[model samples]
Target: MSSRDDTDDLRRPFRHTGSWYKMGSRQSSVMDSSVQSLREGSVSVLFCVLIVALGPIQFGFTFSIFGSLSNVGAMVGALTSGQLSEFMGRKGSLMIAAIPNILGWLAISFANDSSFLFMGRLLEGFGVGIISYVVPVYIAEIAPQNMRGGLGSVNQLSITIGIMLVYLLGLFVNWETLAVLGALPCIILIPGLFFIPESPRWLAKMGMTEEFETSLQVLRGFDMDIVVEANEIKRSVASTSKRVTVRLADLKRKRYWFPLMVGIGLLMLQQLSGINGVLFYSSIIFQSAGISSSNVATFGLGAIQVIATGIATWLVDRSGRRLLLIISSSSMTVSLILVAVAFYLKGNVPEDSHLYSDLGIISVVGLVTMVIGFSLGLGPIPWVIMSEILPINIKGLAGSVATLANWLCSFLITMTANLLLTWSSGGTFTVYAVVSAFTVAFAAIWVPETKGRTLEEIQSSFR
Candidate 1:
């Protein structure tokens, strides 16, 4: 093939229609089946994502909370979520998580002192921590293999939406009202969980044979034949059932360790890239860059993230995960370098100089580019890859560890960002730019192409 043809092949839309079974004669075109599959699965996946996304909103909104305490709370929640998922199942764990979310919001909404605010944020962090792990796992288990990447991308998309909402709302409302508004998703999710079926794979894993079949029917559509898919789940579950409780020592095996490394590494890279630092401190970054309307610029940053993440949902399954990550990290590296250069020049140029204005514009443009680059790839892909790669037996434990690493890195970046900024504005972003450069190399070398593969197929590749 010509070079152009190679490029076109890489960009070509994924052909898998997600039709798990042979459609009857009554079924229409391939488009119809694909649409039907998406329609049936979208409702459950989107609803679950919507509920879990509240956690990300709370995460973003932590900029308004006390220090790094919220992250500390998330660390605690991350450690606990795995056990809750195993004991209560995905749906029940999410339901239980909602109570803390609601109460946490209430505490923040009516805080009489710093103590209430701190406690509230900690509770909120804990709720989000559980949500971070469960939402993707649940979605991956229920979605059809063909559409899983697309559906899994929704978790990140919802998170961007949540963050954007909080950013916009914070402009007008007081902290208390914003806290009250934050409670709304948990309230909706608590009741909405009842309507959705438990994950079929989870049910099967637990030996609930009849419930597994029923849950699979609900997700796949009642009229559809589920025999093949049902058997696949049973076989996958049976294979792992012998080791229902995955111990830390099991991670010594390559099959378990490889995906775990991928998961933890991707998340660590995602956080170390300074996405959260840029997000939480965009207004300050803009102001320091000499933008008069820092709030508007921050809003624009949030908007870009939401739009780019939205685009990722459509592209993830189509363009494939690894390519996007490469593109994203490369773009981010360039953008961060641009931002660092702009800041470097800002300090050197006199305020009265004509070049100062040019530097400010460069800084703003570079910041916007960085946000777009992140939203397109780093923002969503790590979570998608994380959800895709881990085996069912080790998923709960490994996922928690990966998530904890993500939050811990986030805390370190957020806590030190201002100090670093104060030390040297250009140098701060230079460090992040170097990390972004490394991320490109990491994606090229370690990240696998997970598009058009079943969860089992993806996991088996690690062996």
Candidate 2:
């Protein structure tokens, strides 16, 4: 690594200095943040559309299909592509992942049965697996520290927005219409392929000095002042030892094992909070409670989720990471408790139809509280934390690992919810309430504040 002539770069901001952006399997000029985030934010919206819609589209008709397996599909994609991404660069890997959903759309559009729907969901999961890691790491690598949380969280916000879009659209259009809407995002990928730059981190790691320079320029919006930023990238890249290898056996090492457990535990706890059950089963819960108007429940839930998640996004950077987890988790735990009590009351009501004794009021309040608790914490924080702690090198693999746990936990939660309803309706609600209590303990003991930390700093903490 050469010491950059600071004076020269300061004077000639736009001149070519043969910096490192030039070395890669592909070539490109440096780009700016606005362009980068726009592309990333758009992709994030597409992912949201697919994820929220997949459950309703695939499992709405069938009880046994299980929505979380779609999450598992993402896990599988992450596992397969994790280390592969370190070699390929984030942009290339993400573009590759985007294609599966396109294929998934083809399958979904013509689907006639569970098999086809399942396969479509499976493919969509695979696409998420590939891209989820790439996104946060991309934002982390490119975004200035002051703006990291806001920018990193655009993915989560888009997802909430996407969920809002689908639920609203579902009312006006049929399942097929929503399914088609899921595929429309692929169109963005075509332009993304030509415009988006590779991870500058990856470029620097390989020491492709010339290519790095051009990539840096474009990444910085070709600003002559970008040299200082480019140099920061250079030092960050240079600081890490270049030789890297990953083996399954590496999982046993304390450094890897600890953070991996932390990451996955956060994922598991996120689902255990009962957030997803509320999201997927909102209308069902409402109807069972004799809470009139399924559309009202669904739309209300969507709107609150969007609003609460928006608040979360706004404060995620400022309010601090650990605080949100405590607040959100505590709220969810209480909400679930209210929900269980409501179910208990509903069960004992003279006809399971009793309109009064204040049971109905309690049940409705419980339902809304569940949505609020989830939107604020369980729904968004896990993704943000996962993105924060996992660096580019291990991102795909780590994300896959954590997300797999997330999906499996989700499947268990949903299945258990169904089975509990059969065995004892009140018991199912109580179980999650119990889990929520345990998660609070876990968050307090284990999860750290990640709000203001950079990807490197978070990684360093784990060590």
Q: Kindly give the stretch of ten consecutive residues in candidate 1 with the minimal lDDT sum.
A: 9-18
Q: Which sections of candidate 1 miss by over 4 Å? A: 1-58, 65-67, 244-249
lDDT tens digits, residue span 115-193, model 2: 8888987887777666655565666665555556655666566666666676677778776666777766654654555
Instruction: Give lDDT: candidate 2, residue 20.
Output: 32
> Root-mean-square deviation of each candidate, in angstroms?
8.1, 7.2
The candidate scoring highest on lDDT is 1
Give the whole-model CA lDDT for all candidates, comma-separated: 0.81, 0.64
lDDT of 1 at 222: 45
Cα shift from native, residue 179, model 1 (Å)? 1.1
Which ten contiguous residues of candidate 2 have the minimum total lDDT? 55-64
For all candidates, what are the clash counts?
0, 19
lDDT of 1 by residue, 1-463 (tens): 2345324433433223235345777456654665676576567556655555544555455553363777778888888887789889999999888888889889989999889988998898888889888888888888877777777877887777777887889889987898898888788787878777888888877877668777876676544556667766666666676554767787898888888888999999999999877887888899888889888778878888889988988898899999999999999999999999999988888998889988988988988999899988898889889988988887778888999998899789878888898899899999999999999999999889999987877866776
Model 2's number of clashes is 19
